[model samples]
Target: MIDMLVNLYELPDSSELYQRLEEQGIILRRANAYERHIVADWVGAHFSPKWVSEVKVAFSRQPITCFIATREKEVLGFACIETTAKGFYGPTGVGEDARGTGIGKALLFRSMEALKDNGYVYGVIGGVGPREFYQKTIGAIEIPNSDPGIYRDILPD
Candidate 1:
């Protein structure tokens, strides 16, 4: 006889899960205008200040949502959502201290679920990390980038 043990985790609803995030020193609230500016500055140090500014403006103009992970109310991680005529997805980041904890996956799943719920028929994500995760979890595929600098699709067949 062989014995196997599988541990199952239950994901809470948005409100309850958010409470848990609070308890864990994390917060999944929408990023405000100024905070977006701050994020732009911080991330710009490595990426691009122009790109950061673009994202901040984009968030304001569209349904760009963010779920931020925090500790002591300080940002630890964040997932960005951009919803357009095309689809919805993330350019998510997990802090050095928050990686390897399934936070990114959760953020990805949440984004996809929201997209699906909003009646999106397909999703094409830019970049790589979430693309790979989508491939494994939702049967996403890497398609040729229609435009330069973009590459991957997580849409249903």
Candidate 2:
């Protein structure tokens, strides 16, 4: 995987994406501090323990850097910014059943918007999985030689 860079100032308006999700009964918003355990557990079950750790860090922030997609009070997806590092967007995942519902894209936009609100001109999509998705969605450009960037070192599950 490689890291990608996004120009926060150039982010496309997300109203349409958000509205689309709304029509499907999906709600995207920042994770509340009180929901820390629930969200962390959800991430662990749906993604990874490593991501659960990052989710905890996101909850620690004053404004909570994590955003979640939910419907009928059920978690569909999640995105975290400034978790592993500042100006970094990641550790996100949508439940397998929730794929193709635009949850991921909406979460991405919400995270990017939060990064912009945090006074960052550029945001890094650290350790990208689907390179094409990032490139196509937010105009993210690949960072040369970024494979394993900040993801090095050995640790076991």
Pick by TM-score: which candidate is best?
Answer: 2
Provide the global lDDT of candidate 2 against the true structure.
0.94
List per-prediction Cα lDDT, in the order shown. 0.52, 0.94
Clashes of each: 1, 0
lDDT by residue (54-98, candidate 2, tens digit) is 999999999999999999999999999998888999899999999
TM-score of 1: 0.62
Candidate No. with top lDDT? 2
TM-score, every prediction: 0.62, 0.98
For candidate 1, write residues 41-99 as lDDT tens digits. Answer: 55555443444544565467445465556566566556555522245354566666677
